[model samples]
Target: MPFVKTTWRNSISFKVLLAYVAGVGLSILLIALGAVALITSRSDILLTTDVAERTHELAGKLMFDVAGHPTGFDDSEGDRVWTFKSLGVEIGYRVLDSQANVVLASTDEAFWSPVAKSPPSDQGRFKFEREGMLMYAATAPVERDGTIWYLQFAVSERLMELLHQGFAWPFMGAGIVLFSLVLLFVFGACAYFTLGYALKPLREVSESAAAISPRSLHSRLDSKTVPSEVAPLVSSFNSALERLEQGYRVQQEFLATAAHELKTPLALIRAQIELMAPDKTRDSLLNDVEHMTRQVQQLLLLAETSEAHNYSFAAVNVGEVVQQAADYLQRMADAARVGIVLTGHTATQTPWQADRSALFTLLKNLLENAIQHAPEGTQVRVQCTADKLTVRDWGSGVEQAQLPHIFTRFWRGAHRRDHGAGLGLTICQEIARAHGWTLVAHRAEPGLAFCLSPPVTDSPSMNSSQESS
Candidate 1:
């Protein structure tokens, strides 16, 4: 699996959650500003309420007659209404009877007979002239028996400033801060669970996409389980897989046909040369033809091994395969005056999941190559363990730089013998890859060693440790 890097800025869920948070913050700021504006716009009403409350307290202190006229002070004159002045600001008030005649005035400023109006039921403010300055005033009705009296109070700019500084701004600021904190908590919690649920389909789609490879071309994305927004993309990818599978099949068929066409003619040419008299020129031509035939055969095997779908996986006995390869290559070993030695358990000892014919071919090629390079009297050692097969030749090992190129198609090292086309290791590598195995070369003291083993990357503990890290 390949690693994919994701940051908050690049993630869709993170960006959406960020947008959510931004919208919430904007709304709170707007509401706070609107609250400030509302208080500013309706300052008159707040002022009126403050004045009316104080007047009521003052009204309770005075004794009134049945006609709504103040008779005398209910309390001592030391606590009179005139002494109750606003902080840093002076305010004035007038007590009027039903006939609009002033019973008392805080200051004798422009004493005039204004229009007779009834006191309002709801709290409100009104404007009137006090000498030349503009004053905000409110009228509240005072009831004595059945008669009504009006208490009107006036306010100054200084009083409004005092209200803002004393209580209004502080209370509103605290309220907005508290509200914002609560909204942040709720929104954070909701975003976590909601985004997790919403993006689950996308995560599933990612896992399904990861499962796709050349071997699983027949499989398709489960578009029905994905989000509607991503369904089209998954469908398109499945369609691309279909096209790739067809193209691959066509290429494989062509290779097969070409190998078949070349093989028959080579066989006929070899038979014709065999019928001719034996000579040096004839022997050289035959050798060249034999090499060409071997290359063609290797090419076919390479094509088949490269195709993932061609191999049938089963419980292949590792020991049996190794012995069979050694036995089949015995004649070649004898011809080269080299011995084949195998040291492992019985045939049915180990069962590995692999393609039987392909495994046999891999072992045969390794053994044959080792025998070819092996010293005349030395032994080609074959070792089979629980999970691996090691083939070593006691010949001059390849140079360090040449090790990496051993499995390359048609690449031959300096120590590699014969005029053979070099597709054996490449085929073995392809077979190992198809079966999820690892084929590696190592220096075996006096010679070279080729190891075929199962891949160790799929362990659950290793996966967990990797993820944790």
Candidate 2:
């Protein structure tokens, strides 16, 4: 089955959207927590302070009764007549001496306790619990004729409970409403900023990628529009596009060269056959025809490497493949008076996952090119490791200036000694690319050395040994 290809639109946009949503959601959550904490703390402090202040004021007013007259502190007439109302609840006051006694009391006995002890002179406020009821009182000292008097104000448990019930819900409700509105605003703001700034660069990248085509593979997204977090990705993509554009140009040139090379051989063969005579030279003519056919076949192989879908991958034995390619080119090497040698130590039975036919074609082309370039009586060495194949010849090596164009189609060296097509190295490079391998040519001791490494695979230990002899 063919490999399933994934596209940028299907992957990148969804990922960006997901990130934006996550950022907005997290911001809203944090804002809601902060708002809840702030609102609850402020409400508690305000309610507590307000209640304390009211209790203090009520205690202050009752102190004047004790100072005005000595008999005013009496339970029948003094500060006992005064009442304090706040937040729809009424409170009453009284005055007492140091002893466990009531100098005066309010209208309701439950509100003012006869047994309630007087507070210390320095005490400002106190709480009393009786009959499962809670009461609040604030005590203040009153200066009389010669002794100190205590003015105490008390409020009923029911009134305090009513005040709490009234204040709690509204404050809580306001806090909740405020928190909700704040969350809404935060979410909206995050969505706007995330989409506007964060996602804007990604959208521009998408548009730039969409504008790129095979014909314009050199086009790249503007680096300024890329976010710092995504800069590496953009840089790597542009680098890949540059490599692809170069590969495409090379393939186009290779196709044109292959077409020209094939036409020459076909034209020669046609001309020779068309002018053939039924004579004793038929055998020699047939040999020439076979030679021409071989050349045409080699040209076809080179053309196939440049084409898009000319190779496939399968399990292949590296040892046997190298030997087969060597055997096929052995006669040609002998004819050129070049010695071809193959040597390495690896498992001959081990198999690799690669395109077998393309591998052979690649090896054959490299060997033929090496033999052709090498001088007479030179040795062309072919070595194979499980992961790499190397071919070296003992002839004048390529010059530094010509090295760059060694793999370029139809690029011939300055010291050319033969009239042959120069698509051999170009075809080898293309096949290496299709298999995701590397093919490099460099100067050896006396001649050129071409090397091809196996493509990198997920399983590193699959074939780590050499296989050449």
Model 1 lDDT, residue 314, Cα:
69
Q: Residues 271-320, candidate 1, lDDT per residue (tens digit)?
A: 99999999998999999999999999988988888777677676667888
Could you estimate the TM-score for every candidate?
0.70, 0.45
Residue 382 in model 1: lDDT? 89
Model 1 residue 425 CA deviation in Å: 1.9
Cα lDDT, all candidates: 0.75, 0.66
Give model 2's TM-score versus the native structure. Answer: 0.45
Clashes of each: 0, 2
**Clashes in model 2: which pairs?**
344-468, 346-466
Q: Which candidate should be chosen as best, given TM-score against the real structure?
A: 1
